[model samples]
Target: MFGVGMSTAYARKLRWCTLNARFKDSAIVARPGAIRAGDRETFMKIVRFILALAVGIVIFSLTVAAVGAIGHGFYPPPAEFQQIGDRMSDAMRAQDQAAFERTQVELAEAMAAYLPTAPTGSFIFVVAAWITGAFVGGGVAAFVTSWGRRSVAMLVGVADVGAIILVSSLLPGPGWMPFVGIAGSLIAAFAAGTLVASGTRTKPSLSRKAAP
Candidate 1:
């Protein structure tokens, strides 16, 4: 028969293990920053996650390029503007202010054909492309970051959204596109982060039962 003292000791050990498991589980969800000393494996996993986030951004950019090409083919920009744009660049490089200014005005007029007047269908396609790129990129980031902190995956989405804003400013698009694109990017990233974080969570072991 088990003695009273021995039973108490067994219960205490179980309690300690339960608490320890809880702590470790919480740490697993956060990953990275909680790496215990002498745990080189965790440190390397974190490094890989960081590198994965960078690669995610590259993927996003490439997707945007491909999608943009497809969209442009459907609703191409003013054909004449390309030739005028080159002339404008040459004028500026040559320091021919008069020619530069004239070409600039002409280029603006050509671009205007699409801006503030292009069909809503084309605008939808372009905006959707950017959003889709961020969505798919975030998912890839999450998959690669599966072995580490999921929050890091979000950085890719945030960075891409910021880039979208910057590019939009340089080549002004419809006012609404920026708002929609930014919102969509964030939603996609949060979803990816949540999936990876939850999927990696550790469950307490139940394989062994304490002897009575």
Candidate 2:
């Protein structure tokens, strides 16, 4: 009877306050559906990026094949040359130096047509093929990409550099040739990538209406 002033209305008010806070907290947190949707969107972006890289590599291979076809057409090896080459392979297998020299003379005669032509064209073609491939591939990667376009393009550039180094080691050309090839490949690829990335921008749709 002494604490009667602590009435039912005050007790009701305290209970309502506690319920309100719980509801507010629940609203502040994200729903599970929204979180799942966001994760799916991120996964899709990564998939598209992988596809873009694959397309770039395919484009590079096609460019190399096209350039190689041109070289094969321009300097077609003769049937006799093929036969001599086979015989030379047989000599090496049998460890016969005498037979190797005989085949070598025939091969020299067979390759006479190419001698006067000079190997400058072959060197130019190889370099041109690499440069063109890098440019085309990097451009494609950048064009297809929406995120990290420059990074993807750089990967293509580095791939071209790796290929150039491998071929240079096998062919053993002049000491300076690999440096030139690597520089040319990286420059062409990165430049094309930068161009493509920058080109995608369209001066943000003028948000405000033009003045009357």
Instruction: Report the Cα RMSD per candidate.
Output: 11.2, 7.0
lDDT by residue (tens digit), candidate 1, 1-212: 57988999999999999999999998887686545544876777878788788877888888888888888888887768789989989998999999999997887777666587777877888777777777767767777764644566578779878987896886688788889988887787777767766665633232233323
Lowest lDDT block of 10, candidate 1: 203-212
Which residue segments of model 1 deviate by more than 4 Å? 1-39, 84-109, 147-149, 196-212
Whole-structure CA lDDT of model 1: 0.77
Residue pairs in clash, model 2: none
Q: Model 2, 1-212: lDDT tens per residue? A: 54665777678889999999988877666577688899999998898788878888788878877886787577554577789999999999999999999998888666665444546666677777888888898889888877777777778878888988897765555565678778887888889888887777642434234434
Any runs in candidate 2 off by more than 4 Å, and if so which?
1-29, 75-118, 203-212
Clash number by candidate, in order: 0, 0
Highest-scoring model, TM-score: 2
Best by lDDT: 2
**Candidate 2: TM-score?**
0.66
